[model samples]
Target: MTFSRVNAARGLTLAALLLAASGCGAKNTPADASRAEPDPLAKLQPAQDMAAYRAMSDLLYKLDQEAIQRELTETGQEKSTKPAKDKLFGFDATRAVHDRDFIASGEGKALADSLLTYQTPSGGWSKRTNMSTPRKPGQQFGTEKDYVPTFDNYATTTQFWVMANACNAHQDSRYCDSASRALSLILLAQYPNGGWPQSFPLRGKYHDDITFNDDAIANLLKVVGAAAEGDERLAFLSDGLKAQAKHSLVRALDMLVATQVEVDGEPTIWGAQHDDETLEPTSARAFEPVALATSESADLVLFLMTLKNPPENIRKAIDSANRWFEKHQIHGLRYRRGDELPALIPDDDADPLWARFYDIESDRPVFGDRDGQVYFELEKISAERRAGYGWYTERPYKALKEYRKWQQ
Candidate 1:
């Protein structure tokens, strides 16, 4: 849904409040309320040691505050990364995403504390929120269910892994507690069938679908799979979290195999998104058609091959998709809608590539635009969308190369 003017106003208020709680605001709360205390986070910078961590965290929050304010007042300063129409919660302070800097400094601790404020009772956080700002005590924010957390833009999963890294480096109890809660939320948000919905405490839109767009589900697999195999950064994860993540990975693969699109009764590739209940390819945005998608499936196939001693079914699925990739490959064409004379000019040796979408029945490439119009030829799509969307990619080649090694 498009964020209306009214929602935009509401969103700014909530965004500012949450950003303050995440340690981004300029002013510090008085420790005892009556007496003034020195702000420990004044003029901080990114650091690895405890003393530097303190100052670094303060500085990080300060910068974060500036980014949030700029987003609120300026035009086109902070476009939503993974918009959910929640105005306030949907947008993030899209500034320099200094994950390493944030984690190393003392400000990182306050950042973790701020993360707790955003976490819903369900243990997950709202999707597409700025994580740098700290939450204030007794802070009241979010109109309606605007505060419910989700998995989009790698929300809960990202939080879990980052705090896990902090816990590993510093072994701080607060960070550990935060990471533990994130793990609990991760297990809670999972569907019984192993697929993860785009949002938890779902808002009942396409967000409820078992998502593959932007590599959402596959990213989850990598994190949990690493934890299962005992990645040292996340070695502190409880045995129970590891077991749950391992089992969750298995269940997710089942959905993956079940959701593979087949043309003429032969399994081929996958759709960018799928129905959570039916395991069928489903349309997401207006322009996102229900067809065999090469982008996300490329990531998924590579992930599947990472598993050791895969079941025969998975092996067959991988082989089938590779064949599909080989068959549908586009050649000798650049963006046909480019600003140049011939929108699509053929290069002598343009390497084999794939279209983002393909016709389910015809097996030919397809394109769509914000107008919800579908076109068979790239030149037929609108100029804006043709320029904006990635209709062509070499990402599939990464999977194809990995498959060669996996075969050996």
Candidate 2:
């Protein structure tokens, strides 16, 4: 569920292209037509607002670089302090409230109260905020100042689950009302194209992109599907609300099939994020370049596999992504988390590992640093990024395992 940043050189290229497109840069060179590689995403027509999206992405990249530079200039290096466990809060609280008895318990009531207090005016919860404590006056709903209400990191959806369960246990109008508002946020945040953004009330930059990073969109889809299917937790939803959930579910499913990344006219897996309108792969944070994201893609595949008697297109998409996983898995080495930095230890008997990002064209494992340099080897990136981010994952094995059973 970790998200990385992008390569700065690639950002410069994209910025240059934007400038050239706007007639603000020198052009008319015709010497290298033979050397230019055709764009793999050309067939997937860009959205009308693609230029704006790219411009914003470029701007964010620059701002990120500037911020990092400032920190390094002032402090000699970027600070890396891990927050205390009590300070780090997310879906774990909701996950622990599994039964009706727990929901009726005093501790559960306190948790529900804290969640209700923190629910933003827009009806969604913020990521990583300490929901164990009640909101203070004049405090932002989110833990981070810049982050608005979001579905990222199991935020709003998880709160919705907790509230719904609380409603079921106590028949409290407060819990039901809160859960309903959260559900409304889920339905409203989805783009007309049926993809969900990382954060809503449309916080521009990459936050406005159609996000799958940390399974943001995928998690929302699960909640929507559950509501549509009349899940007991959401039994309080009105028929009208349930119908809306059903329609949202249908559009999102179609979007899932349509947005699968393509290379050389063949569908591959998905990227961590996509253009909100174009549905083409796009970059997120500075180190998370536009590439085939194995971890997020595996989650999508698992979700698709859960569909009973899936249509031909859904089945095809699943099969194609599964094949992509099989084709791209790293072998003969295992990812090791070292005290100093992570390493790929040589072990022939080790299970296969998948890089978090694979180059869109070459399919080689890609690593990126806060400086925006993309490297083919993990050793090439900064030690800070190497130790901080999860650059490789074993998540795809679960998807492939499920696929084998699904085939049978």
Candidate 3:
């Protein structure tokens, strides 16, 4: 049934029950929840622009959802036999839809039903079907032709945020339970040094191949924020999220502090750190830091401010990060030390974060390398390859504009 239909029916059923209750168990009716209202989220219910927001959110949500469904179908039928190569992704689409209340009318739950079909025994989702099954242990590789699971930590993070948010809207415990398990996996996956590895098997096995940082931690933090404060898992929940933000922030800050190239006596963050092993900043590639550009740092700063008595250290760290951001933003974009010269990476290869940060103000979609090429490899690929690809095909300007609307 549609969301409105289900909700309306549920509402009427409970009302009829309350009317019939007379003197018995009236406390158990929907009125119980209603009396306990004053919902914290009432203000967030976009009454004024809600219709517009819902329409826009739904369009993107449906498009992304179709891709996710396609991936899930390709994973093979688990009830029969496992496909040789089975990978699943595209959860972000569900998440965006859920958060925007596209599911409020119930259509979103239908999409979510497909996702639940792929859940693993451990409560966490495997990137591909037949993943939980015993298999040879190593970095499994597969081509586009094969359904190899992509083992990125960000995928798990996205699942938590998506599922957790869904649970809130549906008032269903299953989504919350799934979210908790995914969150736990992330906590367990943290390295002794406090950073999360980029890929899965987040243990001693593939220590050599892990580097991409900020995005995963940012995603994790957003999911953790979705949890209710008084929930039973609050302690574990808060600790894990705070630890992620704290440690990861420190590591990121250290990198920024250590390697921010000095141009005209000002320190600036670079695009990607260059280290073959562990991908630390042994060298720097001059793609600009993008998130800080569109006031992303400001958003995080605001989120941090919402904490009741935020730790002094956390506040201090945010302050430092903010200062760096304020100093870095110029002509409405964050660039490497000497941005007057071309970026260190090719234009197409430019960091997406930069587009995100600036909301596509100046240099965006593709930041030009000294040689005038874009940093994104996808941009370099033939137009045929990138044509229908969701992310690659999304120009930075358009992506940022859509995101800005959502934030509103």
- Say which candidate scores most in lDDT: 2
Stronger candidate by TM-score (2 vs 3): 2
Residue-level lDDT for 49 in candidate 3:
28
Give a tens-digit lDDT track for model 3, residues 5-61: 544454444334323322221221211112122211111111112232223223322
lDDT score, residue 61, model 2? 37
User: What shift in Å separates residue 10 of candidate 1 from its native position after superposition?
Assistant: 37
What's the best-to-worst order under TM-score? 2, 1, 3
- Give the lDDT of residue 222 in candidate 2: 81
For model 1, residues 199-262, the per-residue Cα lDDT tens digits are 6545566877888887878777877677676767777777877777777677777877888987
Measured on C-alpha atoms, candidate 2 has an lDDT of 0.71
Enumerate residue pairs that collide in model 2. Answer: 4-288, 5-285, 5-286, 5-287, 5-288, 6-286, 6-287, 6-288, 7-372, 8-372
What TM-score, computed on C-alpha atoms, does each candidate reach?
A: 0.70, 0.77, 0.43
Worst 10 residues of 2 by lDDT: 25-34
- Which of the numbered candidates is closest to the native, going by highest TM-score? 2
Query: Which scores greater on lDDT, model 1 or model 2?
Result: 2
Off by over 4 Å in 1: 1-102, 107-116, 136-147, 336-344
What are the lDDT figures for the candidates, one per model?
Answer: 0.63, 0.71, 0.36
